[model samples]
Target: MPEVRIKKRFSALAGAVLAAALVIAPLTAAGASAAAPVLGTVGTIEAATSDGNHESYWQARYASYNATCYKHSLTESTVHGAVTDGGKTVTLAPFQSSWPGNGWAALIVNSGTSNNVIVKPVAGIAYASPVNNGGQQATVSHWIVCKGTLPTPPSVVTPSLTFTPASCLAAGAIVFGQNVVWSSVKNADGTTTWTASPKAGTVFPANVTTSWTVPDLTKLSIDLEGCRPTQPSADESETVKTTFVCAPPLATITTTTTKTPYDVWDTTLHKWVAGTATSSDVVTTRPLTADEQATCEPEEPELPTTTVDTKPWVDGSWKCGDTTVLQTREVITTVTPTEGEPTVTKTSEQQTRKLTQSEIGTCPLVPGKILSACVGDVPYLSYSVDLPEGFVASSEKPVTITFVNGHGGEDYVVTGQPLSGKLLWPGASDAEPKMWPGWDLVDGQYVETSGNYAWTRLKDVVVKFRVNPEYETTVTYPEATAECANPALTSVTPDDPTDPTDPTGDPTDPSDPAPAPSVTPTPASASTDNTLAITGGTIQLGALGLGALAVLAGVGMTIVSVRRSRKA
Candidate 1:
């Protein structure tokens, strides 16, 4: 609303005095045409206004100016003034304004005056005029007196609530708690009213009635809604019952189970080894029932078909509980009665036989022998010896056997005597070979030893032979012969050895074997960054040759693999 400035027509002296009295312009009734308002009864008040918005204070004088209202309908009266509740006093010092036909009444308190008044006039507070001979005089009955000091209202601090997540329950629930302390004020009627004013970062709980258990503490916050009760109740001191609901904790738990097969005690290895059969599974949340647990257990193994002492196989049990695994196992032994059994006494046997060419075995082929290094292979021989008549080899008395061989040549030689028993071979020079024991065949493989006799399980019986690798030009290996014998047990049959020939040629033809791939050694040059030392040769393949070497190595490995597969 725009402020309406009312101008009072006064003499120059009176205007100067009014201006000196009040800094702000004074308000008056517009177009009154009557003498200035005569000051009526006056009194001072120390009071405050209690409007719906907020409280406001005032300390000012009230007086009756006795001005006539231009419009006098009780509902539309545009005349107003400040007075007591019954219109006893009114004053124009704290002035007012009125529009003749606009039906709006306003009071403008002098902010700069010495009266010490601060008031915002309540809107729509209008007064009716009294009947008179000329016009109705606006009375002061409609004006409300600003009275009685409003005592300083007590400060009410509302309790607050904060939520913090925590593990409050035992494995099943998630929860939170509240902390509050209510303040109260005693009313004149001997009744106590509880109130709260929440601070920042807090929320007042809504008036709810759902209840839940919080394990940490007992007391909970209840909103009684200040002076107003949520329900109709005559008792003012009873505590109100309120409740709230918390969301349930949600989670997904999983479990995985694995079963291993039972182990068997190996008599020869003397250790446990995994068996061939078992069952397993993985599960989540779903626990096995009694029948499922029984059905999933490993079945008992059948008895062994032996009438001797033996260890029984123990089958273990396994099952999945709710998010847990359970297993059990036990071992037992069994013994059989032994009374009427025939104990056969065995005896040792020394026999002599000639070993055939096939029994002596062929030497293995050497592949990719580009170097002049010595190489040897322990051939797989058949050590099948026959027993003497009417006597059998048993666990108590096994047969004793041995093998021997001798070799010699002009250019190269293996000149060891049969059964001299020393680890010696012809040197690089033309010296006689020293006595040498053949390799022992232990666990189906030949192992070198310094003994005159050979294990009965030995595969081959032959003299150790060597070839002179000092030939000036590329040369083929020459044919040679040797004799092998056993003085105490057996001798080797001297079958004529077949001359080695290339599969595509005649045996007697004097042609060189295929020239093996050769690499002539050369000093590495200063510019070469990559060098590989391979028997008598330093390959200078530069930087890019690393990749080339990798490719060639792969090709060589593939060729060797193909050759082995063909031999197999």
Candidate 2:
């Protein structure tokens, strides 16, 4: 039993050693595959394995697909393999190989113990390993032949555009446009580049319609054979094109005028006053001609007067020579010619005549007394009367007449005179005097009259004279002066028959015969004496003496009378 156990243990040990060998072989091969290989083209040899194997051998057989494989110009090559000792580990390599022309290449690996091997191509057919084992030998095939080159990039066409007005033909009207002409372009890669058209400096015709089109283009660049061809090779067989629309142009113009509305004024009324006419109030349809404007002139207004005091004098007063007279005269004068008359003439035969003195006296004089009569009643008389200085005469030609009382009255009559035409008074002419009532007599004693005058009577006058004529005039006489005359005295006696001391029987005694028992001085007789004296004596003296006696009698009557007897 111990021998049996020992034998079994030995068998187990052998199996263990074999299994260890199997695992270690694949691990070692995987480690070796992890290292990168040196790449080379088919038919070219390069060291690929750390054991010094050539890459061309692998690529020429399995990498190249048994037939010779040439390098592809623009693609990569790859290869795949597994371990030789029945392991699951695989190895792979990528190769970047280039050739001058297009061709085919292949890679190959040896099948160990008749196991199958696989190869895969990478970027280029450089070299490859067996698919199942690392210890297997592999080879590649390379065949060289001329393949077609890649196509060149298509050319880009530059488009064109323009604008024109479709509606009005004016300068600033809205406008539309059409595609314009442009150049085409070419690219290096096989790709198409499109470009939009530009519109700078391009003008379309006025009022025209058109369209745009893009034509099919040819391949613009040359191939290795220097042959130009149309686009869309055997791989792509379609054509490209485009279309566009066009636009129109517009029109232009301007405007003007000749006149304005603010230049006219109206003058319809005869005068220029407020509310008559104003510049803005007048409207003019057209401009006035120079002649029409020049002919316009304003009219004049009529003169006005008041009837109350139209003449030169305030009343009928005239400024005659210093004295005025209530005289009348027929004046001879030429009149102002009327409208349309040629000349006025004076009448040859006594046009007017002076009033006779008798005619003047016919008008009753004012009832007041005469205060002054500077100009006497006479014909053809002119004199400056002596009137109180600074006294305004009722009339410049004043005829002063102070009445008995202080009342003043006047009756003046003036007529146009013959020769000198009534001797034009200071403020009067040959014109008739305009008379007003009410005299404006200020402080003064007299008035004077001037002008030709004549007097008919001089009654109860003070003094009168005529100047310039040196004519004698008469005045009424005044009363004469008187002297005092004395008269005889008469006596009164009392008679009695039985007297004691009587001889001839004269009853009244001369003295003290009988103190006639208190006879009252008969008031009647005293009053008679006063009357006689008042009537007979000088008026001034009798009045004074009587006045004194009256005063003494009144005082004495107030006192008591005392009588005394004399002892004889």
For 274-339, candidate 1 gives per-residue lDDT tens digits of 565433333223343454334332442321111111122222331111122232222222221234
Q: By summed lDDT, which 10 consecutive residues of candidate 1 come out lowest? A: 557-566
**Which stretches of model 1 miss by more than 4 angstroms?**
1-120, 123-159, 162-165, 168-568
Candidate 2 lDDT over residue span 1-568, tens digit each: 0111124465467446645644565666677755333223223233334222234443444332333332211111223222222222222233314532232233333212221222233332333322223552332211112112222334333333343322222222212233544443445653223333435554445433333322323332233122322322121111111111111111111111122232222234221122222221221233334443332222312111111101111122222121333322221222222234333232222222333232232222111111111111101112122322122323433343211111132323332221111121112211112100111112321122332111111222212211111111112111111000000011212231112121221111111122221211111001112111111221122342223223321010001011111111
Residue ranges of candidate 2 with Cα displaced over 4 Å: 1-102, 111-126, 131-293, 300-568
Steric overlap count per candidate: 9, 97
In lDDT terms, how accurate is model 1? 0.24
What's the lDDT for residue 19 in model 1? 54
